[model samples]
Target: MGTAQAAQAAQTTQTAQTAQAAQTTQSAQAPQTANAADPGMEQAPIAYVGGMPPVMDHMIYSHALLDEFEARADGHGGQFRYDGQAWFGTDYDKLWLKSEGTVGTDGRFGDGDHEALYDHAISRYFDVQSGVRVDLDNGPTRAWGAVGVEGLALYFFQLEATTYFSDRGAAARLQGSYDLLLTNRLILQPQVEMNVYSTNDRARGNGRGLSDIDTGLRLRYEWHRKIAPYLGVTYTSSFDQAASMARTRGRQVHALTVTAGLRLWF
Candidate 1:
């Protein structure tokens, strides 16, 4: 009876040990099961250690345009005319050069206007410019201090308004243009310019008050974005005292001319 009781006690102890071992195994596997069900809890967040990349605003650039390089034929004779501009700088600031003039059939140049300006962007579509203007041609030469505003107006009209101060007198100019696209590669443009002066300058053929106005309509075909050929008609007229002065000199008060030209840009 005593041996039988001892054997039963040993078996009871073995059963208790097996149960403890099974409990320990379940505790170890519980955490691994939870991690497998929710893997995101074990992941580390990403960090940005490197700096940002560069931007293009700091770079410099340049552009040139020959807006008008045309030959004009009037009733009296034929003449050549040119207007061009170039600029160098960043997007916000630039140095600009502009020139325009007419060459007579006799090979004499007249009415040459040249300007060098500093331009600053004042708005998304506008700029404020201050500069010097020099009239250099076969006749008398004049210099002026110039200030102007140039921009795209309502509905994308290009506009410029400038005032000039000089020893001879004060002068003002207004210029505007609009492009009407007729097709993907064809465009029609209308342009106008007016000049006004405060004093008479017989040497330069300018008179007090409203001096002159020039208007043109042109049709251009763009074979490439940088090159276009155009045909146009231009009307120029003297006004107020300018007309009287021109008539006294036996010059025509007005002229209507046909033109052929090329427009180029780079």
Candidate 2:
């Protein structure tokens, strides 16, 4: 009976040892089993990512207009007008549209001009742009190819220079403006625009040389960045044959007037 009891105890010990060895082997092989089951587990740290979004695309569809509304002198009579440009897109590329015209008291939209442009940033402060321009009234419905540059100069001044070309001829326009901040919300802006031509278009009453110039000084108080009311003084003058054409139409070649209007953006 003593021998039989010793043999039974040894058998129990061997069975326990076998169970412990099986558990040890499973622990060592568990990670290898998982890696074989999922091939991605081995390559998870080095998987490639492709086709990312454009670096500049995160800022989309921001738009603004620096000058949008006004009333000005045309002759002994006068006209209300809105001249504005708006742009939208990412910082690197954008679409631009500009429109201006007189709203006649006689219920006509006269002297209308419109342009559509694509703007590409070439430097930190400037863009190169190209587009089409259409003169809607006062001239034949003429379309021209336009190329231009618009930018900040000397940090505080805004400037634009553009040339237009069509079968009739080529013309150029230059514009500049500076803002004087009287306070956080009060601003004084002095703006100037000049137009020149390469040939005469009698139907449109445009001259071949320096044709006309407009200069204005405006003071505005902005309740917000999106809106402002302004009062200003403006002077417009014609030169060379352009002046003669104005005289022939009995229109004032040079006029000074007061302008009161709003500047708005969204």
Candidate 3:
């Protein structure tokens, strides 16, 4: 099993799959919390769905010098997010992981459909992560970010922590992705991701008590080169009892967003 100690589960690594199940797993297991304006920014929408559970054994290793810009709707509020991630791997299992950070600006309406950002604000933050995969007789399994000592793919759990100006907390993510290869060059992937918030903005009496879920699916044709690109659709949803309360208290939200984008690796 290969697990990185300092990788953020939010970062993605472009890995080709060999089948539909793997494609579906890759799409279903990614984080989608950021954007709607840019095609490259919008990935799987599951990152904002709030209460969905993390998928198992999914990991994305990002380049150390890459950045992404994204825009999306948060419930009724529109926001833009930007992220950058870098990766490192060890010889042990060829295990690779990445670190990521993000910043967001809001442009959504206020409580009464008034001017956008009337009472809302923009913020910036960063997170740390790590992940690993395991090979088993029954199946290939893994864990990312703070993987505990249980289950068949004991090393596939993903971990993340965010520290913002007004809110600071940590979350544990579980996800897995596999692929279906079509002639060794064509493939389909599915992914699932679950996010559990260990802390929320408890100060100033604001914040949802918990976190959300994110998932994705994608298909691609690989040329067996140093760089590859692919296209796919994504879905997102959220769940948190505390978030409900925060909504009731007049917070900004969008609830859902569907997007398309390309995936690349070198």
Runs in model 2 with CA error above 4 Å? Answer: 1-58, 73-75
lDDT of 1 at 1: 62
TM-score-sorted candidate list, best first: 1, 2, 3
Best by TM-score: 1
Residue-by-residue lDDT tens digits, candidate 1, 98-117? 89999988899998999999
Error of 2 at 57 (Å): 5.3
**Candidate 3: stretches off by over 4 Å:** 1-86, 93-97, 100-170, 202-210, 245-256
Residue-by-residue lDDT tens digits, candidate 2, 1-266: 69999999999999999999999999999989998898787655554457454454558887768484987754477778788888888888999999888786666776688999999999989999999999997557888999999999886699999999999899999999998999999999999989999998777778889998988999999988789999999998989999999899887789898889999987
Q: Each candidate's root-mean-square deviation in Å?
A: 13.4, 11.8, 30.5
Q: What global local distance difference test value does model 1 have?
A: 0.93
- Say which prediction, candidate 1 or candidate 3, comes out ahead on TM-score: 1
* lDDT (CA) per prediction: 0.93, 0.87, 0.38
| By lDDT: ranked, best first | 1, 2, 3
Q: Highest lDDT among the candidates is held by which one?
A: 1
Q: Which is better, 1 or 2, measured by TM-score? A: 1
